[model samples]
Target: MSSFPDYYKILNIPKNASTDDVKQAYRKESLKTHPDRLANASPQEKKTATEKFQAVADAYYVLSDSQRRREYDALYSTRSSSDKSDDPNASSTFFNTFANMFASAAGGPTGTTGDQRGQRPDADHVFGDVFEDLLRPEVESRVPWWAWLGAACGAGIGFIVANIPGVLVGAYAGNRLGAIRDAKGKSVAAVFSDLGGNQKAEILRALAMKVLGSAL
Candidate 1:
């Protein structure tokens, strides 16, 4: 229970306001201090508006509900004239504690709970972060270990498949050529013919250059 909360003052409702009066008070407060409306307000004003808005919202929540309002009235009247600073959570902690203390207590706030986020578990959405922290670097990379081996094997197989026909043709042509030789002591003409028509011409031109200098 908060000391001197003055729900009437908080909601701008008069001392003798009724249920509808409490609701209208809350509607007006919500309109004025809702975060969207206060976005352009100065920091000090925004803070003040936030406090007032919270007070009004809490007041409306209790006053609008019949059973809750009765319990709230008891607690509010008990604390209205009492000292505050005595309890840290005085403004926010009363209802749940009061209900737990009183076996017969029961009720949801009438139109709005005013504690929407407070009622839900904050760690449900946060659990995944804890899980991510564990699995973060443990999962192996797609390119790691045997994946590289498989890629290398695939590349080698593809290279051999691509060159097989040309290698066979070169061997066949080289075998058909007689024992032509160069200083290397092998069939130079056969090797040139194995390089195919254009390559053989290029080889002949290069050999001529070697024998006769640039005039070749």
Candidate 2:
């Protein structure tokens, strides 16, 4: 499982977002994805809405607290982050359970899950600048705060642009249901690196389908 949930990405907030900003986002998102809003949607659509709702709640829970988030940062230090790389399937389930529990406790899903035990793991992404690479904060003779901000914004734009190709390819590949379906129930799981051969790639992909499932 990936160590971080790419909190900024999950919340659609800049790394520099203030506490108030985080709260605003949570409120907006809750209104948008509440189960009541999804009640009329199809089963699959409802599931999607619920997952997104969970994400919003998860993002809020982490960013709302101060002490817990700081401690979380100390534990999972890294140079970068990604929500996709993290196991969304697992994270979503955890959040749903938490949300449900909270709802039950608070007169409930209508309000929020009151029971914290089943809730998703506390926000672990806002730890002290884990995305060190994305926010250089200095470039020329130690750039000033304004310059650093520009660079951070520029880096974010560039990052999105850089990801377009991969996103397109993944989207295209996602259409091939048959290929994904065939690579299930594999016999092995092996971690591959740059030195991995074509055979290794095949084996790993096949195994991934089995273990992670195509849709998941």
Cand. 1 Cα-lDDT? 0.44
In candidate 2, which residue ranges exceed 4 Å CA deviation? 82-90, 93-216
Candidate 1: segments with Cα more than 4 A from true spot:
1-4, 42-45, 80-90, 93-107, 110-216
TM-score, each model? 0.39, 0.40
Global lDDT of each model? 0.44, 0.44
Worst 10 residues of 1 by lDDT: 120-129
Clashing pairs in 2: 73-127, 102-112, 102-113, 102-114, 103-108, 103-109, 103-112, 103-113
For 32-147, candidate 2 gives per-residue lDDT tens digits of: 55544543579888777666656666666655656434533443354354423333454564445334433333221112334343345332222111211122222233323333
Q: How many Å off is the CA of 12 in candidate 1? A: 2.4
Clashes of each: 0, 8
